[model samples]
Target: DVKVTQSSRYLVKRTGEKVFLECVQDMDHENMFWYRQDPGLGLRLIYFSYDVKMKEKGDIPEGYSVSREKKERFSLILESASTNQTSMYLCASSSSGTGGSATNEKLFFGSGTQLSVL
Candidate 1:
């Protein structure tokens, strides 16, 4: 089974502090993504990388950044944490192939990290 593991299931930090969230996938998938899920706004993509050392900014990248130094690892960074940045962060991976196991490929998700900024 494809597994995505997150470094932390929960995190707490104070405002103005820097925070990091790490994620690793075991399937050797080529695409990895970081998303912040909010109650009414839904899942908002923060960053994604299709290849090693290559990354693209998502819809909400203002307070977030991502690093993909290796094929199976992706990291999310919060430069200066704030109370408003508290949210559920999710990491997901998908195969690079056009179709994986079926006509449409499905994304495998990690358990998610709940970050609280005080």
Candidate 2:
């Protein structure tokens, strides 16, 4: 099975500390994304990388950034944590091609990281 593993399942942070969350995929997918999910706001993308050392800012990139130095790994950075940033952080990976399995072509998600900023 294609698996995406997140660096954390839960986190507690102070108001202004920097935070780092890592994600890795075993399938070597070409697309990696970071999103924050809120109760009613749904998922908002923070950043995405299609290749090593390359990144594209999604709709909501403010106060957050990303890095992908290797094909199988991606990292999200919260420049300064705040209470508003407290939410469920999700990492997703999508293969470059649809291939044979339509269901598997969609994004595969990690368990997620819940961040609580105090």
Candidate 3:
């Protein structure tokens, strides 16, 4: 079975601290994504990578950056954590679909990392 594992299920940091969120996928997926869940905002995409060393900024990438140095690993970095950034971070991996169409892709999601910034 495919599995997406997040390094931490819960995290807390100060307002100005730097944060790292790690994710790994057992399956050799070509696409990896980072998203954050908020109360009314739903799931907002922060970053995504379609291949090793390739990354693209998603809808809300202002305070977040991603690293995809290896095929199976993707990391999300919060340069300076803020109170408004406290939310549930989710990591997902999916196989690249034919013709690069996302409609046929199935994503495997991690349990999530709940971060609290104070």
TM-scores of all models? 0.94, 0.93, 0.94
Model 1 spans > 4 angstroms off: 99-104
TM-score of 3: 0.94
Candidate achieving higher lDDT, 2 or 3: 3
Root-mean-square deviation (CA) per prediction: 1.7, 1.8, 1.6
Number of clashing residue pairs in every model? 0, 0, 0
What C-alpha root-mean-square deviation, in Å, does candidate 2 show against the real structure? Answer: 1.8
CA lDDT, every prediction? 0.94, 0.93, 0.95
Best by lDDT: 3
Candidate 2 segments whose C-alpha is farther than 4 A from its true place: 98-104
Clashing pairs in 2: none
Distance (Å) between predicted and true CA of 82, model 3?
0.6
Pairs with backbone N, CA or C atoms under 3 Å apart (clashes), candidate 3: none
The alpha-carbon deviation from the true structure for residue 5 of candidate 1, after best TM-score superposition, in angstroms, is 0.4
Model 2 lDDT tens row, 60-101: 999998989899999999999989999999999998776677
| Model 2 weakest 10-residue run by lDDT | 96-105
